[model samples]
Target: MVLIIFFTSLAGNALMICLIHWDHRLHMPMYFLLSQLSLLDMLLISTMIPKMAADYLTGKKSTSFIGCGLQIFFFLTLGGGECFLLAAMSYDCYVAVCHPLKYSVLMSWPLCLRMTLGSWLLGAADGLMQAVATLTFPFCGRREIYHFFCEAPTVLHLACDNTSLFEYLMYICCVLMLLFRFALILTSYGLILATVLCMPSTDAHQKAIATCSSHLAVVSLHYGTVIFMYVRPKTYKTTNYDKAVSAFYSILTPHAEHPHLQSEE
Candidate 1:
């Protein structure tokens, strides 16, 4: 099942990348960021799922300390990057709809590239901080992480020493990085709705609403799963349901952002 999920997601995202790269009409800022998003999702799922599937199939749960840290590092980095990227994408849509005159100038190639780079950098830095703080703590026993991947909360639960400080710090970072981006996304959509209401053209108004609505659906799935997985207390035992939720955002969202659909719409 895990292997099935991994390959399916991989194929879907690969197709998205191909479509985005090959289609000249999909060369706008929105699709450009989405292509980058597809790439990020590919990397994010590739990092964890292949190994996890292999381990599950072979019944070998063992992972080196360094390997575990690397898993957490990539997972959080991509996760945070996706959050910001989604928010950035929403902002792009808002600009395109609300400020059509300035849309091209504001979301130029250089600016889009910078936003992409900044999202990755910020996410990496945040992930690094969490990984360092997590791995530095001593683990006397209970090496088994409840989840398939090395999630921070689950990994922290395995530690021998006190983790209250680390847990609190991680929570703080989650609030800042994850919740902050979510708030910005919601605010952008709210402003977008307000702007769309004033537009007289029914066609333009409907299209604008459709775009934002699709974006909101994606955002809800991505952030909802994440908040459910990570925000709660560590002692909370992870269920198969939790794993399923994680897979949705980690795999499904990128598929939904496939370039073919973007171009058609």
Candidate 2:
């Protein structure tokens, strides 16, 4: 599973990057955003999976304080970045389908670059905040982490004091990271679906539906696991159930970015 996850995500993201670079036709706002998503997913999974592989093979299930802190930081950073990038992709789809004529004007290369940069900056800020907040909590010398890798929720579970402040910050970040983008993706697709059905030509409608549908599919899969993982009130200390879900997003979500980009061809 480790070898599979590493090579597949690496190849998948690498291919998406290659496609955007070599194919001039893909040098547009949509594919550009995809390239960013690919890059972010690669980084996101890389933060968790390599450590997990080593732990599985070596039977070394423990991470040092520094290692755990850094892992949580990078995981949140990349994951948050992808959240914003996906939202950007959804909006690009919205404009391309619902405002085809203005897509060129509205989503120019400069604007797209700016949006991507903004997503990265925001993600970094959130990651830094959450990392500090989480790690500062008193752990009461508990060292064994039940999850496969360090995560905000898993890490916070080890805290010995009232985590109300950290939990509030976490909920706010989750709302911004998942729900905000979710609402945008849903609104874009709603308008997209209505517009596509009203189009006069079958071919034109089909093409628009295909594009919007791909983005919607990704949104559902990515956010479904994300909201399930984070947005709820903390429940169990650790469960195979949570680990399985986290593993899916960590392993497969990056893989999904590649085929979706390929389908555009």
Best-matching candidate per TM-score? 2
| lDDT, model 2 | 0.79
Collision pairs in model 2: none
The worst-scoring run of ten residues by lDDT in candidate 1 lies at 256-265
TM-score (all chains, Cα) for each model: 0.89, 0.91
Candidate 1 is scored at a TM of 0.89
**128-230 per-residue lDDT for model 1 (tens digits):** 9888899998888556766778877777777889889878877777877778888988888899889878877777776776776766787888888788777
lDDT of 1 at 217: 82
